[model samples]
Target: MKKRNLFLFYIVVILFFTGCVSLKDVSVYKNEEISEYKYALINSTESLTSNVGTTINGVYVSEGKTVNPRDIISGYLMKRGFIIITEISDDIKDKTLIVNYGESGRRNILFGYTTEVTLQFISAGTKNLVCSSTAEGIGDREADDIKKAITRALEAVFEE
Candidate 1:
């Protein structure tokens, strides 16, 4: 019995330490040329609502809040000295950078939650793909994991 308890304790410890935010994969198709664009627009394709929760007595109770990935992307761009534009005007399109973002996540039975964030940067004027990147993170909570993934993804996209 003592040996069994010790093994169980070790398992718990491993899970606790392993359940953390991390970048899984990062792919940069283009270099840091995105710095040339002064204005940016974030287009998020992720679902508005996240269904990360637990089932309680046959009903699903959500523990994670519905967070818009666009907000996070916007903040990152602003911090990078890029002006965020709400609307894309024809005149500004030539100097504007368009960001397309998407996210997906799943819960692990033994570990925690895993979140993946994908980003694509396009030049509004030329309508060309400037850069793209992907990042993944794991955490005990859904919201935190998603945020971590987004941050990592942005870093990968900007190469900063």
Candidate 2:
């Protein structure tokens, strides 16, 4: 019994450290002046396509706030001198930045939890991608994994 418990403890520690890879990658385009535009938050398309089995320390994790990628990205942009506007007007299309983001994740019994988010910055008028960033994070709990994915996505976009 004691050996079984010790084995379980080792597994948890390994999972925790390996999960903290830090997701530090980003790509920023300089053609368009991102800092000079007024940005609008576009609601992220999110879903939990499947949750057949999610566990922490071998116990199922199924309760937590459903976080949106838009919120995290916008909140981060707010601090970077961007005015987060609700409505993107045609008049400001040249100056408005449309943020499009999405996230997907799955809970694996063997690997714990993993999440990935793709964030895009588009110029409304040109319909061209100004900049884009992708971030990935992991956690034992589903909610933490999701949150980390979003926060890291934002960090990568700004890269600050």
Candidate 3:
């Protein structure tokens, strides 16, 4: 009886710690002109955080560490052949794309974290919207949840 009870306890613990990621409420829109751009500038809004952490100017800082979602978004854009630009200069304005990224609806569940991420693409010169997408992710860790949420959101935007 003691060994059976121990085995059951172990199983419960394993289940509690195991992580899971999911995407939902994904919406995507793309404009035909989006293909004309080759460079991108990413702008991120303030990230929602639980009461336990602090956010500085749209950057999430926890335990003296900073988490910037723009970095993740930049990586995805690079993979899609978009050159990342730090600023908007007249020389490249006509061929540049502006990407707006934000996070919202962050919550901590009983044993995991959930995050919702949104992405939008726009033409820098024309100032017109090109594409947009929204996605949600859930996992045992907050960082992983955010990462997966952004990845899923970008995938939805690019239809990949």
Which prediction has the highest TM-score against the true structure? 1
Worst 10 residues of 3 by lDDT: 44-53
* TM-scores of the models, in the order given: 0.73, 0.68, 0.71
Tell me model 1's lDDT, rounded to 2 decimals.
0.77
- For lDDT, the strongest prediction is 1
lDDT of each: 0.77, 0.67, 0.76
**Deviation (Å) of 143 in candidate 3:** 1.3
lDDT of 1 by residue, 54-145 (tens): 88899988854566788888888899899998889998998898898876445454455577777888999989988887777665556676
TM-score comparison, 1 vs 3, better candidate: 1
Extract clashing residue pairs from model 1: none
Candidate 3 lDDT tens digits, 33-56: 566888999985454333345679
On the 0 to 100 scale, the lDDT of residue 117 in model 2 is 65
Model 3 misplacement above 4 A: 1-22, 44-66, 107-110
TM-score, candidate 2, is 0.68
- How do all the candidates rank in terms of lDDT, highest first? 1, 3, 2
Cα distance off (Å), candidate 1, residue 24? 2.3
